[model samples]
Target chain A: MRSLPPLSIFVFALSLLIACSHEQDATAGSPGAVDVTAAWARPSLPPHENSAAFFVVHNRTDHAVQLLGASTSRAGVTELHHMEMDGDRMRMRRVPSFTIPAHGELVLEPGSNHLMFFELPAPWVDGEKVDLHLEFDSLPAVDVLAEVRPL
Target chain B: MKWACLGLLLVSLGCSDSDAGLLDFQGIGGDFTLTDEQGQKFSLAEHRGQVYLLFFGFTHCPDVCPTTLVELQEVFQRLGGAGQDLQILFVSVDPERDTPELLASYLQPFDLPVIGLTGTVSQVEKVAQAYGAFFEKVALDSAAVYTMDHSTRSYLIDGEGKVRYIFRYKDEPERIAQIVRKLLP
Candidate 1:
């Protein structure tokens, strides 16, 4: 068997270290492990006191992830809400948590599950961007920037 | 016999070139007096020659109410100049919270010709009952103490103030505009 050169051995060892670190990152539950996409919120009119934000949470991990809640400086209170149709009537209720299955996604959209913002400090205007801090059951909190769009 | 066959075919297909194809909701709607956003008494009988779209909702409803109004704005945009003949009557089911001023402010964002209507609890109840609309206040544990759950249908009244058709929740805006156009002069 032939032995490799000193330079070749050093480069091979560095590549191995980088590969191991990348694998470690995949299991560390970093913000990059989970993805939040299509984040947008509705523009709020005066005296309405409330608005809603929608997005899709994609979990790439091997285990199911639970989304506990979210917070934003734009509103005094933020809660998870689901809108359901009972016959011809529409009902909105608070939800405790949403679980995203392994490699699955949870979609929050209009007329469905969403993040309800109550007691808005100021009305959300079209083209305004709002920062949201999302908390999870196990992973580190993720920060998202949602755009305000007219309904 | 050929003419008789053509008549049967038309009847089976429900083919019509006029308002004969429109749904008849004759018994569902009637005249009701409510306070408009300007704090003036608004009687349905007063707007006899104009088309009206009536919707039951509240100002604090975060999702459906605004979504419906925005859809109405799109409908108006589709209608263009003809939309001026159409008036939207937004009846507030949450009489305790949705004052005339609040309804006015909430509806200001939508550029459509909208009349925000609110009245006393009993008055609102009477109007809702006349149209078979259902609405109730639901309590919550959050800072926003309660929310209103209401029917999500839009009643389309023709120029003569007769309920001609009912638009379900999230109906296509283009279709609504098309139906409303048929009602215009």
Candidate 2:
């Protein structure tokens, strides 16, 4: 087998190190026993209306975790909601709570389920991070940062 | 055995007739008259030679509506020069709050030539019925704070003013562009 050149080997090792660090950064900031990742919100044109945020909640512990609710200072009120198709119409319904099963993950995504922020006081600035407080039944609140981007 | 052969022959005939490349969407939509964002009288017949993508939504929809529009914007970009022949029409289901001026401003940020249309409740209902779209006003505890529940599907109309395909909100935007390019003469 032919050995890779010294310059090529150095570059390959550097890239591997960068990839590992990025993976660590993604899973680094977990509050308590829950791991939240890929949190993002769709940017709203006129801030006064409602908007949505999406993320994934992973339960690293053996016990089941229930997402009771969520809150944000930017909106007057925030609610847990999901979209359902009734006939041809798509309607948004408020969900009381979402459960993160033990050793499993709950994904909040677009066109399915999301965190609806109603009556936003101001428009979400592009590229800004909106701080979201996710409340659990027994665990302490987890602060997830959702980056606002144009949909 | 005779009846089975007859049934097979009938199925073949049905498949061949719908292979005309228009997808057998004959009765889904028809011509309608409405007012555009500029308060001008608009008719479906006027846009007969241009392909148009139609969606039913409201200005206040924070999640699905805007998300779909933004995706459409990417579709426009992917179409490149061919996009000039494509028209995006946003029909407001909540006519009470989606006025001409409001619709104009609400669609400005998408950076696409999105025409907003709203009419009287009955007028809008007629158009929605033509496309088999659903929209209903859901009143909350407070009368002033309410939202509309509407369908998130978009219709792809060919240049000859024929509804050829239906794109659900989850459909990939590139797939929509591909269908439109094939339909564009």
Candidate 3:
């Protein structure tokens, strides 16, 4: 078997070092990298009705994470809901959990996956904020503020 | 794939119909009288010379209804001067909760003059059937809480009050605007 030239061996070793350091830096720099962004809810048009909230969950960690569920004080029941397409019909149902892949994002937005609040005591008026508690597996629950905007 | 190809063919033909300044649409909608947002009698025949978009929804709808109306508003804004000739009729399927006052307040965010219409359950059902739409009251639990499960399609009616196009809920505003501009005088 032929051996690599000295110069080529040095270059290969240097490249490997650089690549490994970059990955280490990426993982070490981002601790508990589940980020919640753009949290907002659509104002309940009529009081005591169901309302929906939207947000983007970005996981920068090197391992997958599961969004177990959510809670809110403004409504009697808060559940994770997903919109399903059956043939041409669109339907919504409660989902037990959602997964966010390592270094990926899970977006909960209008007409897709969303957090549904049911039987709100009062309408989530525009310009007001709702307190949200997001639970995940093996991580501290995240307390978030979601603003309400008129649809 | 075959249906997609056929749809493309129909779209091309629709484009030609637009160019001809006459939409050779199979007649679908007819005159119906309902109470408007102002609690006054509204007759479809009265708007004979204007183009209009019609949708079936209620005040309590969270996702689909609001999204569709906002998209239609975008289409109307895109039409600019021609938009003035376009009227929007939003018929409430849940007549019990969607009074004229509720409808007016629910639609305030759009900042457009979208007329809200509602009537007796059978009256609304008859009109929805005529437009090839579906709606039902879905009971959620034993507490008597209910939600409406309804179709999300919007109908485009021309100056002659003939249904010219049925826009899907996901249709882009620009795409609907293009067709509406073609139908407009």
Candidate 4:
């Protein structure tokens, strides 16, 4: 597919806005049995469109844990999606389950495991926070913040 | 002799430590095979000695894809003629609509040597999975136009074909350019 390139100056401004908002944690993230944080909304999307919330999930337990499901009020439904391909096709599947083994971590960034909002309840007025109710096997379900970016 | 052996063991372990979260376990960069807009086959192995910026999205992407690529072009231009060996690849996550001919024409306007790639639905899926990129086709029953929602990211591959960095779609151009400059020949 193709798109007309945007002007260089607007690109610069957009880059600057994002640079201030994004933070990378190579060492440690949310301190909980099942950790999650760094959530952000897709800035360019409209209300009717699907949006993804990116974050990092870490499991510090001795036994493996699974991310069974997710719930969010901001959107009608949320699911744990893993990126998969049959051959030349790239599609995100709502996995039956995903395991974060003992002492292991899952980074739900742009490309990996992330929360998918199938149908947003309303147009994301940039900067609003959407809450995701995270579900895990043994860990108590917790709510995480997803910051909406101005489109 | 015991002291010397302890030093050697510690050094070996230290050298072995690297970020495990980002790369796959095989120790090889994820495997991918797709056709370029010019009807030419392209693979990561073919560009082992040069740095490349990669973006995975459909040709019809309305926002993130174009925004990310333009920033990359700015970085490439900032690098001047030194970016000649550096490749910028756009892999179409939506194969149903993106053909080689469409991809070729899509990249014609860009100042850089940008190659647009597309393959069968399954073929492109494999490519996206290999890079850890995610995409989903949005179905619209009423509207003629639909969109493929995808990861808004660009991966930076070093000369050795290792994915060294995954730049956020909104990262600063100068920081991206700095990383490219260090990897450039």
Off-target runs (Cα >4 Å) in candidate 1 are A1-31, B1-18
Most lDDT-accurate candidate:
1
Cα deviation of A131, candidate 2, in Å: 1.3
What DockQ results do all the predictions give, each relative to the true complex? 0.63, 0.29, 0.20, 0.03
How well does candidate 4 score on lDDT at residue B28? Answer: 23
Better of 2 and 3 by lDDT: 2
Clashing pairs in 3: none
Question: What ranges in model 4 sit over 4 Å off?
Answer: A1-151, B1-29, B141-144
Real A-B contacts recovered, model 2? 0.55
Q: Is the docking of candidate 1 incorrect, acceptable, medium or high quality?
A: medium
| C-alpha TM-scores of all predictions | 0.86, 0.80, 0.75, 0.48
Model 4 chain B — which ten-residue stretch has the worst lDDT? B20-29
Higher-scoring candidate on TM-score, 2 or 4: 2
| lDDT accuracy of residue B179 in candidate 3 | 83
Candidate 3: where are CA atoms >4 Å away?
A1-33, A46-48, A59-66, A85-88, A101-104, A119-128, A149-151, B1-23, B141-144
* Residue-wise C-alpha lDDT for candidate 3, range A34-106, written one tens digit per residue: 8898999987764347889999998877788889989899988887877754543556556788999988999
Q: Over the stretch B1-185, how does candidate 3's per-residue lDDT look in tens digits?
A: 99999998776546446444444444356778898878888989888887888988888776888877878778878999888888888999899888887887777767566899998898898898787778888766412266677887788887777877778787899988988888777
Model 4: chain B TM-score vs. truth? Answer: 0.80
Go through the candidates in order and give the C-alpha RMSD of each one to the true structure.
6.6, 13.3, 10.6, 20.4
Model 1: per-residue lDDT, tens digit, A28-128?
66546689999999987777588899999999888899899999999999999989889779998888998989999999999889999988878898898
